[model samples]
Target: MKKIALMGRSEAGKTTLTQALKGEKIHYHKTQYVNNFDVIIDTPGEYAQTHGLGHALALYAYEADIVGLLVASNEPYCLFPPCSTCTANREVIGIVTKIHAPDGKPERAASWLRLAGCKKIFYVDSKTQEGIPEILEYLKEDGDVLPWETKPEADGKKRANELPQEESQ
Candidate 1:
């Protein structure tokens, strides 16, 4: 079964994002498993972008086929540092979280995430269920950035510098 690990700091909405992908909101752990296309393991939240918990979980997600990283949009750098993790593996996908506000729109959201090197970033509104299907299609499609390239490509980033790494906040 293909595995999609949702990695991010606490309160970043990894659990909520997983629930959206699964099409359910049952009470319990936020982690979810729905069909073979999607599977997310909810890791603890990390408010800051440092070592220990945050680093450990990032590594764990890197090992998986796909990593849906959740980051709060308002946070400085918008948690862009983690987007660099995408360079570690081709399966990495950046996801902005907690974006349900009057000003929460795709244009700005995409811009923030883009600074982190995510060309195919997808937004998630934990409170309203927006942009969930886009993520689902991304997952079911096997994490391919190119809509036409169903197969993995060798041009994927090989190192962190190969990915987007703006100055961390």
Candidate 2:
């Protein structure tokens, strides 16, 4: 599985979602600093809320193959600027959480992420693990390309013998 970086505003369920993705029991732990797990990087919301700390996300993204920009369904506004993903080198995807909230408006939150330039979007309720499989599938497939994985040089076809050889130390 590819490592994912979770970034969002405070109380947006970043930690909760991280736990869900890891198949662990959800626990509330205030993320005062960046928490690096084997397959996830949970960032403090302040990093995304404070402009000065915002640059830290770019640095964190370097360590992840996927960057998840989360927005709660009931969020009143977006913290991210338009086309934010355009600045990221890694694949940036949007996640809309709290889909089960009474006042949840996942569509609105999704639109905000779309405006932020996320190439793909997912809507999920971390509490129930709804819609989580799609995210897992995406993470599994999207980042599976090996460094030496070869592509068709032409004609949209690649022969087995033409596969790029893995370098030996």
Per-prediction backbone clash count: 4, 0
- For candidate 1, give the lDDT of residue 84: 74
Query: Model 1: clashing residue pairs?
Result: 9-45, 9-46, 10-45, 10-46
Per-residue C-alpha lDDT of model 2 across residues 1-169, encoded as one tens digit per residue:
8899999999999999988888789889899999999889999999999999999999999999999999999999999999989999999999999998998899999999999999799999988989787787777755454322345546766645454446322
Provide the RMSD of all predictions against the true structure, rounded to 1 decimal.
14.3, 8.5
- Compared with the true structure, model 1 gives a TM-score of 0.62
lDDT of 1 by residue, 58-91 (tens): 5665556776666666554455553475465646
lDDT of 1 at 120: 68
Model 1, 161: alpha-carbon shift in Å?
Answer: 44
Tell me how far the alpha carbon of residue 4 in candidate 2 is from the true structure, in angstroms, after superposition.
0.7
**What residue pairs are clashing in model 2?**
none
Report lDDT (CA) for all predictions.
Answer: 0.60, 0.88
